[model samples]
Target: MPSRARLKPRKMPTQQRSKATVEAILAAAAQVFRRHGYAATTTDRIAQRAGVSVGSLYQYFPNKDAILVTLAERHIDAGFALVRLLLREALAETPPLAAMLRRFVLAMIVLHEHEPELHRVLFEEAPLPSHVRRRLRERENELASEVSRLLEAHPEACVRSPDVTAYVIVHTVDSLVHSFVLHPPKDIDADMMTNEAVRMLLRHLTAEGS
Candidate 1:
């Protein structure tokens, strides 16, 4: 991982044109990273892909690592947005635990399935900055806290420690969903994966003497 200073973008876009340029760079960087793993991607390649000059690219991002950091930040933000939307819907409906867990699991699968290659590069291949990793951990903790609240409210939940259970649930769903979508087995598919994950979670949360 690079130092925070090294991963920082050179400048922030303020004007409409500058913002568009920044967006173009990020989009191009994502494509480049997807096509060629992070190790092979370069600032010049991203500049060419964005149809911008190297000088212009430098004006916004100091280096490819900076661009990667921005991409990672955007990816994290989009993921959180999706999770929050599902959480809001779950809260509104107050569905059965099975249904809720299924929804969460399916949503995660779908999110990863959208661009599995890009996700793999961002999360698995790229060297994420320390701050970005910290942010991810913080977001996961926040999500776990929300899940804990939901578990506490549910009548069927029999877990002794909602906090611990919620943390486990969040990490389990995230890990399994990512693995199933990004590196699926030859025999198992998304539907099967979701069903098994939900079943396991339901049993753990609601089983007798849990």
Candidate 2:
């Protein structure tokens, strides 16, 4: 039962060299965590993998948990950045609900594809810290808020509750895309899966009278 404070970095890197060292540590951490998983990963192994002294690793991170938390934060930040980009694109065109959903679904699929194993290690398999989990939830809520606005602007999306529908939309797309792309269940075609997801969403959004 470690405190959140124990997970916080001892000091932020200010100099360029120190910054590079931090980046190396993070890159090495990704490999080490993916290779060893969370529970078994140690600061000594991460430092060795990074080609840095263990004392140097401790200069930035207090413990192995700090490194993992930092890595998870970076991952979540990237996901939210993708959401922000799509939010803007969706707003500019205000395409049909299905069209917008398709774009989002595909973009998310690509994001996951780029680093599925690392994502699996950080998000799917590991036991995340409470603060890290809270950060992930906040980013998710931010994406949900964007979806709510997108639905509000979409000419065809007529759900009674935009907020709740937005929650359903985000979770449904995220969970379905992650599960399907990362671990397809026997003979799932990507195009067919995308089409059906779009169809299901369009139905939920435009269905009249509950």
Candidate 3:
């Protein structure tokens, strides 16, 4: 088997047409990989689904893992956008921290719900390259840094250690949201799960000098 180091995309798109083709290929790859499973999916299948020739697919992605990595990056980028938006507007709002946390949690749920099947394949099933895995960690850290800064600025934040608290909050919210939303228990309501998540974080952060 080929090593993971060879999995990165051959080159980034620089022109309008190239960008469109890359987008189409990634969009089709999400569908193909989700429907067929990662191990069974092939570049030809993705090319056919994208309505582009096999040559065109190879022009951007060197292999199936490259396509998978790009899809993962796109998905993570959307989540990053949500994080930026919350940091931009939500933190400035006068709402309590619980309300803000609820908003963040709900936004994540919406992202997962938008394409649950594809998300499962990319995040849980696909054989992600090392860089792809590292990218995911970097994104988490980026968001954590932003959240830590926000906590420091907020008067209500009682945690003496903003960075540590931010890391815990990011991973906690991410793991619980993915688990309960994707493979939800038969008995618990989704909204209730989300609300409970918000409450859980609020209690930890709001206590005196927590």
Rank by TM-score (best first): 1, 2, 3
Per-residue lDDT for 1-210 in model 3, tens only? 246656777888999999999989988988898899888899999999999999988888788887777788888788777766776576677467777778778866776776788888888888776777888899889888877877776778799889999999888888988998779999899788987888788888888485
TM-scores across all candidates?
0.95, 0.93, 0.88
Question: Which candidate, 1 or 2, has the higher TM-score?
Answer: 1
Highest lDDT model number: 1
Total clashing pairs for each candidate: 0, 0, 0
* Candidate 3 deviant stretches above 4 angstroms: 1-5, 11-18, 208-210
Q: 1-210 in candidate 2: lDDT tens per residue? A: 268898787899899999999999999999988888877889999999999999999899989888888888989889788867877788799887778888877877876775677788887777788889899889889888988888888767778888898888888888998898778879778899999988888887788435
Q: Judged by TM-score, which candidate is best? A: 1
Ranking by lDDT: 1, 2, 3
RMSD of each: 1.3, 1.6, 2.2
